[model samples]
Target: MARAFQLAGLLRLRQIEKDHAASDLAAANAFRRDAGERQARAIAALHAVPVEATDASTLFAMAAARASSRSMLADLAALADQADAEVAEAQTAFGEAKARAVGLEKLEARHNASVLAGELSAEQAAIDEIATGAWVREREGNEA
Candidate 1:
């Protein structure tokens, strides 16, 4: 019988960690995209604001609107930066998990190969012993 991999549990845990890291990376990328979109919208809104100042009140309102849009854009930029950092961290984690899993898999493959070679060697030895027994019986009959 083939022996079970000694690090099977560790391999499973590493696989789970890799999956979680992948999920986190995807989420982080989505958040970054969303923040970028919001920033673009804020910029567009700021640009669309009418510059025509028919009176003092309209001019003051335009100034306030521009100020709010700029503030929102700055906040979104910060969010985007944070999201980018998260993605980088997740990618690093995924890479490490993948490397660990690959290492364990290689070890398991090597162990399995060794087991198979041992079984084959045993079978060959048994066949050789049977052939020798048959040869000895034939020689004894001839001598008689």
Candidate 2:
């Protein structure tokens, strides 16, 4: 009989952790994409603003609008930066989780291979014993 893997339970836990880390990384990437889209929209809106001035008041208003748009752009840029940081952190976490799971998986594979080799060795030994017994019986009959 093949012996069970001693760290099966731990391996399972590691797999679960890896799955969770992957999920978190996906979510972080999605958030980063959304932030990037928002920033793009903000830039487009800023460019779309009309700059034509008909009077002093109109010019002042346009200037104020430009200032507000610049502030909004700055804010969006900050948000995108924060999202990028989150993505980096998530990637690191996923990498660590995957490394742990891979290590355990390799150990499990080695253990299984060892068990199979042992079972095969035992089976071969049994076959050899049977062959030896049959040869001894035939020799004894011939002698008798």
Candidate 3:
């Protein structure tokens, strides 16, 4: 029973670790897509103007590029923070899983030892019964 509980706990902890890893991967992928989009937008703004045109359109485009770059930087910072948090959480969950697995292994070893001890005791009892029966049969033959 104790072994069963430990195994159950280990499985539960491993599941949690898997979930945390999935979430971490998703967040990283989202961040990558966000960076790609920001780069594409910036490139588009840069390509909007000819080299000789010094007009408001060109200035606005440059400003827009700067703003987009800054926004992307801010977004990346936020994503980094979120990713860090996820990594910490996943690490914690993995540690928990490792601990649970170790505990389950110990519990199983203990249960096996107990089973072996009981078997030995039962074998001893059987041997004593057989010896007594054999002795009784020999004495009956002698009396005859």
> Each model's TM-score, in the order given?
0.80, 0.90, 0.50
TM for candidate 1 is 0.80
Cα lDDT tens digits, model 1, 1-144, are 777878889888888988888888888889888888888887887778678999999989988987887788888889989988988988898898889888988988898899899999999999999999999999999999
Arrange candidates by lDDT, highest first: which order? Answer: 2, 1, 3
Cα distance off (Å), candidate 3, residue 120: 3.3
lDDT of 2 by residue, 13-80 (tens): 99999999999999999999999999998888878878799999999999998889889889989999
After superposing candidate 1 on the true structure, give the runs of residues whose Cα lies further than 4 Å from its correct spot.
126-144
- What is the C-alpha local distance difference test score of candidate 1? 0.86
State the weakest 10-residue window (summed lDDT) of model 2: 42-51
lDDT per residue for candidate 3 within 1-144, as digits (tens), equals 212444556656666766666676566657656666666676576577455538999888877867886787677667666666666666666566667566666776787787777788889999999999999999999999
Candidate 2 lDDT for residue 112? 92
Name model 2 segments beyond 4 Å from true: none
Clash pairs, candidate 2, are none
Q: Estimate every model's Cα lDDT from 0 to 1.
A: 0.86, 0.95, 0.68
Superposed on all Cα atoms, the candidates' RMSDs to the truth, in angstroms, are: 2.6, 1.6, 6.0
Local error of candidate 1 at 37, Å? Answer: 1.9
What pairs collide in candidate 3?
none
